[model samples]
Each structure stands twice: as structure tokens, then as C-alpha cells.
Target: MSDFKVFPFETEKQWLKGRMIGIGGSDASAVVGLNPYKSNIELFEEKIGRKIPKDISDKPCVIYGKKAEEYIRELFKLDYPEYQVSHHEYHILQSLEYPFMQASLDGELVDQDGRKGILEIKTTNILQSMQYEKWKDRIPDNYYIQVLHYLLVTGWQFVVLRAHLNTEWGGEKRTTVKHYFIERSDVEDDLKMLLEEEKKFWEYVESGRKPPLILPEI
Candidate 1:
């Protein structure tokens, strides 16, 4: 197996840093380095209490994500008319205690079957969580932007979340499936603006200056 462990110890901090930079529209996988420990794939399956297919991990880097993503799509009823694999490359900046950020992403998905769009895979227990509204929406922006920013970069036709509820805990035996389709122009604009701001921040970082003390628009 791979030498990766679960998200552990300083990993939470690293995850936090990556999360913050992500709000500023940085690349995903930017903070993975900070996580000295990582979760095993088995833990992922076990926690989800589902069997990850044998070939799931064998796909080419470009298509590797779909292995798990598709199962989630099928289970969640997320529309995946067709899809194309998209690869992620993180650009690291800074070297403080946690470094700038070790961001990575749900990667990108290109819908090929008239469903031309972006694919984002989410794993959460949100199924039982009550629904909230925008403006008053309590959902984390970092989480939304992870996919938003990726969509901003690629100009994909649409953005889709092929997600599953991680209900393997709480003695629950069945998993929950879900999907979110974001095909809004306003959101795309907002994400682009956010990415622009992040690019500005990156320029400062490249010049060895600390990032501005800016709070996210939660």
C-alpha cells in the first residue's frame, strides 16, 4: 500500500492552513505536506462502511478520482451523464511553521455526456443536517469555493458535487447519497473575483510578504 496515513496530529493544522489559503483561492493539495499523517484508504471505506472497488485506485491520475466519485454519483443520484478526468497541480508558497498552504482538491471532472461540467466529490454526514439558506447559509465558504475556484479556472459548463453522506458512524448501516448542481453565472463571477484576490495574495507571497489580514466572506 501507499505510505500515507490518516489526517492526524499536525495534519489538522496543515488542513486548516490549506483551508485558509483555499478561501483566498489557492490550489488544493497545497497543504498535504503539512500532514505528517494521513488516513488509510481502508479507513475511508470502513468509515463509509462500503467497499471501495479494487480498480478504484488503479485509474490514471487524470481519471483516478472517478473511481470513487462514480460510485458516489450512482449512490447519490448525481447526474453524471458522462465525465472526463481532470488533474490537479498545487503551487506552494511560503515556509512558515505550516508553510503557506498545502492545498489539494476534489480534483476536476469534465462531464462528457451532454453534462459538460465540473465534478466535485463530497463526503459528509450532512444528510441529517438541517437545510440552511444562502446569506444565512452556514455552510463553510472554503468548502464551496474549493469547487467554485476550480470551476473558475476551467470554464467548465457546469459544477456538480458527486457526494455521499459519511453515515458509517452513529451505528448507521446505510450511506446517504447526495448531489449539488451549481450552474449559476453570479456564483461564477463571485468565484472569479475571489480567485483574482487570491492571485493578488500570491503575488505578495511570491515577494516574501505575509498575506493580508483579510477575512473570508462567510
Candidate 2:
């Protein structure tokens, strides 16, 4: 099991500073060029304090997700009564083995069998068919990378991702809720790969060298 320390912050400013101290789940995808929004070079600049991270808290989608996360996590608890869910207010988990690795979990889980897992809640607005396709039969690639990073940090046994997708079909508004479970055992190789990639990216941050621009395959 990975050893971790909980870092608590009382304000958003403190949280942002805490995040800069290490690589976060959201940053993991960018490290490997899987994140659709951010590039590895951008992440490196942010980590090294060369560039200010964009503040997305004002975005409507971000605002809604923040507000809905608690409700969604609660729903998961009701949906899976056999698993106990717990959360700590404004706390971040930092790995002891890799002090530069961290995770901000939505909720932590303990199953009836006492196996530990992670609960990740996501609220997304899908406006196009392409967006829906990302969730067709599996979780989105970036999200998959994200949960794996969490697994790497916490050494947890599994992760349960609850996604709430809002979309419009036939001119009618609709919502689709789904759960994707990832077991550490099933993706040990992936976790190892992600860790190596993240370690490489952190080296770039520490050395103040920008990573080469990596684009998604066409």
C-alpha cells in the first residue's frame, strides 16, 4: 500500500498552492498527452510557477459540477449500500513514496468486505454526438488516466466513477447517469506506465525544461 499524508486547506487560494506542490489527478492525463484540454508543457509551466493556471471556477459547467458533486456522491452511497463512503472537507492526499504525487478525491470508499476504493464524481454537459461517444461503452480516456493516477497515489484496491451526463436528444433535455468501476489489479500495468510518465514530466518541471508538444493521434 502507498503511504500518504493528508494536507488540508481552508481556502481556495491555499488549495491552489497545495496543488502546485505536486502532480494531481487532473494533471496526470496531461503528462501523457491524453488530456483533451491541457498539454504537458502547460502543466509543467503551471507546476514551476512560470504560468498561472487558468481559473475555471467561473465557468458554468465547473460551477454546476462543484455544486452537484456532494449530491452525486450521496446518490452513489444510496445506490451501493454495501460500500461505505467518506469524505474530508478540503483535504488532499499526498503520496509518501512520491511526494510530488497527490490526489484530491471526491470520496473514499470501504466495502462490506473492508476493501478500500475511491469514489469519483463527475458532472458533464454533452452537447454533441462525439462527446457522447466518449462515454459509449467506457469511461473517457482522460478520466481513465485520472483514476489510475489516484490509484497510484493512494494504492487503493478499486475506484468507482459516477458520471452524470446532461444532453439534448430529439429537442428534449435528458440526463444519463452511469458508474464505471476500475480495479487496481485489472490495470496494474497501466498504473505503472502512468507513474513512469508522470515521473518524467515532473523531471521536466524540476529542471525547468519544457516537454515537447504532444498532440493526440488523428
Q: Taking the tens digit of each residue's C-alpha lDDT, what string does model 1 give over 1-218?
A: 21111222245345543343322232321211111121222222322335332332344632534356556545434344455555333322222222332234444555545444555665544334442232122224545655555554444556766544444447766654555667747485766565565556455545554443443222
Residue-wise lDDT of candidate 2 within 127-149, one digit each (tens)?
A: 88899899989999999999999
Looking at model 2, the pairs that clash are none
lDDT of 1: 0.43
Which candidate number has the best TM-score? 2
When summed lDDT is taken over every stretch of 10 residues in candidate 1, the lowest stretch is 29-38
| Residue 119 miss distance in model 1 (angstroms) | 0.8
Query: How badly does each model clash, as a count of residue pairs?
Result: 16, 0
Instruction: Output the TM-score of candidate 2.
Output: 0.96
lDDT of 2 at 93: 94
At residue 190, candidate 1 shows an lDDT of: 66
- Would you estimate the TM-scores of all the predictions? 0.48, 0.96
